[model samples]
Structures are given as C-alpha cells and as structure tokens.
Target: MAHLRDDSRGQLLLVAGLALALVFIGLALVVNSAIFTENLASRGETAGSSGALAARAATEANAGTAIEQANHYNPSAPVDAFNRSLRNVSTQTEALSATSGTLSNVTYAGHRNGKRVSGAIDRTNNSYTVADSVERVSGANGTRGLVFNASDLPGESTPLVVKVNDTTATGDRNSWRAQIWETTSDVHVKTFRNGTSASENRTERCSVPSSTANRIEVTAGLVNGQPCDALRRNDSGANFWFGNGAGDEYDVHFKNTNYTTGDFEMVVYSGGGPSILLTTLSDDAIYDAEVQFVYDGPDVWYNTSVRVAPGEPDA
Candidate 1:
C-alpha cells in the first residue's frame, strides 16, 4: 500500500511541472508581442513627424514661387496674379502629396493686393498633418511703394493726413512732395520720358520740403473750408517740372513710424483717398510707393502681413 501511494505522488509532481512550463511559454509570447507593438508605434510617430515637416517645406516653396510670379503681374491688378498663384500652388500640391485630396487648397486675401496667402500639405497614409501659408514681407529691402489712382479714393472732399520723412539723399536727388488742386488741379499729360517738364496754370500747386534734412507731418481736413491734403505729384518722369528734378521717392512704410523702417522711408494716411498723380520719373529706377483705393465710402489700403516661418507654427 505504501509503494502505491509513492507512485501516485510522483505522477502528481510531473503534472504540476508541465503546467508551470506551459504558463511560462504563454508569458514569453505576451511580452514579445508588447515590445514589438511599442517599437512599431515609436517608428510610426517619427516617420509621421518627418513627413509633415517635409510637406510644409514643399508648400512654402510653392507659395513663394507664386508670390514672385504675382509680383511680375500688374501691380495695380491683383486678382489675376492671385489666380495664377492658386494654379501654381495646385501643381505644387500634386507634386508634394500622393493624393490630391490629401493636400489643402490655397487661398489668399488683401485690401489692395493679394498680400497674404495660405495652404496645407498632408503626407504618408494621412499619419500626420502639415499646413503651409505665405505672406508678403516688405522692408527687407530698403525700398517701399504705394499708389492712389483715380478709382482708389474717389470723392475729393474727404479728409486726409499726409506725412513725410526727410532722408540724407536730398538736393541733388532728394525729393519729397505734396500736390493739390481742385477743378484746375488736373494736368493733361502723355507718356513719361526723361527730362519731362510741364508748366501748369495757377490753380493747384505742388509742395516739397526745401530742407532735405527736415521731417514733415501734416493733416489736411475741413478745418476751415479746405479738405485734407495728401502726398501728391502732378508731373511724371525724371527731372519733372514740378521739382528741382528727380522723383519724389516717399517711404511707403505705413505701419512703422520709427523712421527706421527703410533706407529712405515715409508713411502717408488719409481719410479720403489720395489724388492721382503718376510717377513722372518713369525710369526703371526703384522707388517706394503707397496706394489708397477708393472703394465704396471709406478708402482701403493694403495691410501689411507676415508669412509662415521655417519652424513649426503654434497650434
């Protein structure tokens, strides 16, 4: 009887050992699977982040190219340029993304120009998202520009504030002027040429700072019976009759007033639109400009804007 009991105990011990071994095998498989899952997740995150950044780069390049192309178009007319840019961006998006739907459409807005634009690029199984946009950055160069045509600001009675800052480039080439006239102010002229000069009958007159080193800040309003004045010029072309010669290059930097905005800069503001006076000095010579368009009632000007940075934007 004792020998039988011993044999039974041995069989029980062998069964328990087998069960323990099976449990260990099952545990090993679970641990291995967990590690593999973690590794895959890490890799996927890294790849997605990289792809998103790449997409941003592609879209930004496209945006900049569009803006340059737009710049060559009619500076007065911006819609055509915007359309052209949108088309180019579409082509760029195609190159950047695997699917058309994955990339976001390009868009733009501005008062006087298509100065600001936006878009997005997506990549890699939609694992991550990349957004891109571009803005017109001025002041990098030492020049500024603005325009106020016939249609920009219509009515003549609106008040205006004309401001000017003097630069060291005076006398021989320094030019700062404000032109004004009523029914007698309009001057009939043809295309501009070098040494363009005209003598207008006594009605509207032109004014420029005699002191090249002086700064000017004047507002034209219906104080007594006079409307606000603006940065004005009647003559066009190099060596204009209105001047001691040379173009009246005003700084078109409106927002920044520290006078540190550009190489030679000035800012002009007017409640009413600016009067029409073409740049008589029609040389390829670069000059800063500002334009105020008269839409419905209030005049509109192109607001300055910034573009996407090389780094990631804040969410």
Candidate 2:
C-alpha cells in the first residue's frame, strides 16, 4: 500500500512538471510574435514616409523639366518627354516601395506668377478624375505659384494648361499680342508695286510683332476692326501693308498649319519700349497655351513657392 501511494505521487509530479513546461513554451511564443508584429508596423510607417518623399522629389523634378522645356524651341516634344520622365521617376520610386508591399501615388501641379492654375487627370474608367489645387505667392518677377496634384497614379492624363509668361517685348507698340502661325514657312513679305509700273518694288518682311520669333497666322485680319498692321512693323523697315485693297494691305494667313513641332514663344508686353520674349515649346494655337509646374509637396500642410529665371542659350 505504501509503495503504490509513492508511485501515484511520482506520476502526479511528472504530469505537473510537463504542464508547466508546455505553458512556458506557449508564453515565449506569444512574446516573440508580439515583437515581430511591432517591427513590421514600424517598417510600414517608414516606407510610407519614404514613399512620400520620393514622390515629392519626382514631382518637383518633373515640374522643373517642364519649365525648362517651355524654354525649348519645340516645347510639345520636351513637354511630353518631361511628363514621361516624371512618370518614370514615379514608377521607379513605386517599385522601390512596392518591393516591400506598398503602393505609390504620383501627381503634377502647375502655377505661374503666384496664381493657382487649374489642372486635372482622367482615369481610364472615365468616371473618376484627380485635380490639382494650386496657389501663388509674390516673387521676384511677379507673382509665382507652385503646382500640386498634376498627375494621378493608376491613370494617365494630360496637363490642363502650360504656364508661360513674357519677360520682354520690343516695339514702339506698348500692347503685346500672342500669335500662332500654322506652318514653319508662313512668314509673309510685302512687296510694293510702283503706281505706274509693275517692275518697281520694295519687299518688306512682316512678322508678328512680338519678342518671340514664331509667326502666327489667323483667318481674321484685325481685332475689333483695329488693324495690327498699324501697330506691328519691323524696326528696320515697314513690313506690313494695311488696307482692304488686295495690294494696299497684305494679310498674313496660315493655311493647313502644323504646330506639331512645338516651336513658339510668349510675347511679354504688347506696346512698350522694349519687348521681352519668353520662349516655349511648339503648340497648335494660342488657345493651346498651358501653365508649367514648378513645385509640389506632401501632407497638404506646407506652404511652398517656385522661382523662374530666364534660360540662356548655350554659347
């Protein structure tokens, strides 16, 4: 009876010890799991912050590229290139983050002279769109603004407008006007015919009176019946002839014009002592003008500004 009692007591002790060992193992596993979960959460937050910074950097780089392209002879191509570059940067940054299981959102925002320019992107679904809300502040030349939300991830869209401004104009005329000539060869020259003979003549080449060099041709001859011929003339000679008569007045008109090359300029002042011309990419018409992007930020909480300096030609 004593031996049986002793054996039963030993069995109970062994069972209790086994239970305690199992319990300890379970507790250790739980603690290790908690630590792993905490580490993962911290990594995710770090990724989000890094992603935002990368996206913002890409956005600003794109804006700067677009602005520099605006100074190019063929702006459309460069502008297109600029957009592609931005997208590429976005993709790369997203890929970098996506390796860690995070998605990316890239966008564009544009502004000029410190004013908010309207911008948007339409997704393939056609039911949704992302829009940029821009704001401006005072700058060296004038008011300048930063662009935001210029692009959307998971969708491709074009800029609503390209930002351009004239820094100079040269002419006796104080008022500056922008013109869009359809063809590269549309520049017009006026030939004066002798009153009595067809042989006597002086050829005057007339171009759109703006600081920029591209000539713009339109169907209409004048604005509000006010003749541009009177206001526009080459400083060296009288290039434009004004009058309803066929020979007395020559109207420069462009037919079947191709603005695809994107060679154009922004005339800063209309009638003034000297005109400053801001060069831009090629565009079809003055109506196709757009604002360029300069800056972008995240958190929707910080105030930012952009500075535009005249780009000079390479020596």
Candidate 3:
C-alpha cells in the first residue's frame, strides 16, 4: 500500500510542473502583445502629427503664392488659383483623420511677414472670409501739361478755386492771353487799358455792321465817355484790336443779364497772337485764367483756364 501512494504522488508532481510551464508561456505572450500594441500607438501618433503639420504648411504655401501672384501678375488669376489650392488642401486635410484629429476648426491664414494681406478664404458649407485694400502709386515722370477738356467748366456762380502749378520760368501770370467770343446780344465785352484810361469806359460797344448778316463787330475802345485808339479793325482777320502799337496792360470782362442763354468761347495764347482757336461756346460765359507751368526758361508757359459755362464744362 505504501508503494502505491508514492506512485500517485509522483504523478501529481508531473502534472503540477506541466501547469506551471503553460502559465509562463501565456504570460510571455501577454507581455509581447502589450509591447507590440504600444509601438503601433506611437507610430499612429507620429503619423497624425506629421499630417497636421503638412496640412498647415500647404495652407501657408498656397496663401503665399496667391499674394505674390496678385502683386505682379493678373489679380484674378492668382486669386482663383489660390482658392483652388486652398480647397484642395482643405479637402485633403479634412479627409485625413490622422491630421485634424477630433477638432473641426481648420482655417487658412494669409500674411506677408506678419502683415495681413488681402485675399478671400472659402471655408466649409459655402462660408467664406474676404479682405481687401487699395493703394495709389504716383508716376515717375510727374505731371505733364494742364489736362483740360470740355468737361471741367463751371455752370453756375458757385465760388471756385483755381490751382496753378508753375512748371515754367515765366513769372508773369498775365502773360497768358484768352480769346473770348460772345454768342448773345445782351452779353457785352469790356476792356481796361491801364489805369490812365479810366475805369468806367472799359466796355467795348458791339454793333451789327450789316442788317442782312448776323455779323457783329466791336469797334473803338470806350475811354472816359469817348472812343480810344484801340479799334476793331476788319483789315487782316476777325479779332479785337487793342490799338496799332499798344504795350499797355489790358483786363477784359464780359457781363450778361441772362445767365442761361449767355454763351462764350475762349482759347489761350502765349505771345501777341492766340494759341488755340475758339471753336466751342459755353452758355454761361464766366472763366478764370491762371498761369501754371513753364518750360525751357519760361519761353513756353502752360496755363489753365477754368470756364463756368451753362452746359457741361471742360477741364
């Protein structure tokens, strides 16, 4: 009986040894699995971080390209290209779960060395952000001649301020001459020949030479209730005569009763003769002539005449 008991005990010890080995194998498998899982998690985190960084970089790059293109090339082309690139980047980033993570706050910012540039940003769900700015740049050659056309004249008696830039050497503002033509009979022309000729008789009388034709002639300068030597000579051309050899200063003023129908035309001249011909007439004959720039040691001067006319005025 004792021998049988010892055999059973040996069999029990072998079974216990087998059970211990199986437990150790199971523990080893568990530890290896934990290590593998940790490695996978670390790799996923790194991939996600990289994707996010890539998306950010793409956004910045697209913004920069768009701004640069707008400065040099056509503004629309670069803007469109930038918008497309941004959309592409946004789409790609949103699709990548590893990049954006659980946050949905994805945005693209545009700047030039910390200075915010003008552009348009399109977000999700058709939402967008836009920024714009305007800058004026001057020309290198400066201003040319006085830019005057038939669009800048005054229509009423509103007080106007005329600005003149002296680009020429001529200091004499009165050197510039203007030829004015009256269209109505009520409007009269007056000329002042120095202070010695009296002030009241500065107006020149207008008369109809022939009844058949509507030709009007201004003959003889009114001086102190008498006719002066300055006469409207019909010898050479149709022009107001200021004496044969008169070197005196003259100031001409036109007065009209009706401001609406009263019309006149004028052209600027440099020396004795007129420069440009008076082809057009203004309804309200009121103009101010000022000297502007002069070129080549004041030999040629640029002048601007602002006429307040009835209709649309010229600049």
* lDDT score of residue 185 within candidate 1: 29
lDDT by residue (tens digit), candidate 3, 213-282: 1111222232222332223422343233432112222222222212222112221112222112111211
- Comparing 2 and 3 by TM-score, which wins? 2
Q: Candidate 1, residues 112-150: lDDT per residue as tens digits?
A: 322211111111221211111111124221222222212
lDDT score, candidate 2: 0.31
Identify the superior model by TM-score, candidate 1 or candidate 2.
Answer: 1
Q: Pick the candidate with the highest lDDT.
A: 2
Candidate 3 achieves a global lDDT of 0.28
At residue 230, candidate 3 shows an lDDT of 25
lDDT of 1: 0.30
lDDT of 2 by residue, 162-236 (tens): 211122212211111222222232322232212223343223333332222322221122322233342234356
10 residues in a row with least lDDT, candidate 1:
292-301
Clashes of each: 22, 42, 17
